[model samples]
Target: MNIEWSALGSVIIWGILIGAGLPALFALGVKTLAVPAGPDGERHPSLGRRVGAWTCFGVIILAIVGAVAFIASGGH
Candidate 1:
């Protein structure tokens, strides 16, 4: 049996990076968005936080779409 060591290593590394990194980023975004309530019981996330969260989500969505497209195009 023959194994492509480099290809196998690349896939493992990429899978861990993307699989873990994306969720971690998304979690960070969610954490930023979760603002604590003030004295008046109003919880407001800053505009920057909201934007960051959306950006994270957008990146995740784009990645998923790209993966789908790659599959559709019969990429390895």
Candidate 2:
């Protein structure tokens, strides 16, 4: 049996990236929302942080949707 080392390596790289990167991205979003924005340490985060966090979450949602679509297409 012949093993395609390059293809296997690519699969491994993508797997690790998607598996770890998404969660880390989520954590970053959470941190952005949770951290204080002003010197007075206000309860609500700033507008920029809110926008950034939402953008991160949106990207995650898009990734999930894309993956489901790909799988439904039988990995065309």
Q: Number of the top candidate by TM-score?
A: 1
Over 1-76, each residue of candidate 1 has an lDDT whose tens digit, in order, gives 9999999999999989998999998898788888998899987888898899899889999999999999999994
| TM-score between model 1 and native | 0.83
Candidate 2, which segments miss by more than 4 Å at Cα?
36-43
Q: Worst lDDT window (10 residues) for model 1?
A: 25-34
Task: Give the C-alpha lDDT of model 2.
Answer: 0.90
Please give each candidate's TM-score: 0.83, 0.81
Q: How many pairs of residues in model 1 come into backbone collision?
A: 0
Tally clashes: model 2.
Answer: 0
Global fold similarity of model 2 (TM-score):
0.81
* lDDT (Cα, tens digit) per residue for candidate 2, span 1-76: 9999999999899988988899999998998899755777675888999999998899899999999999999996
Q: What is the RMSD of candidate 2?
A: 3.3
Clashing pairs in 2: none
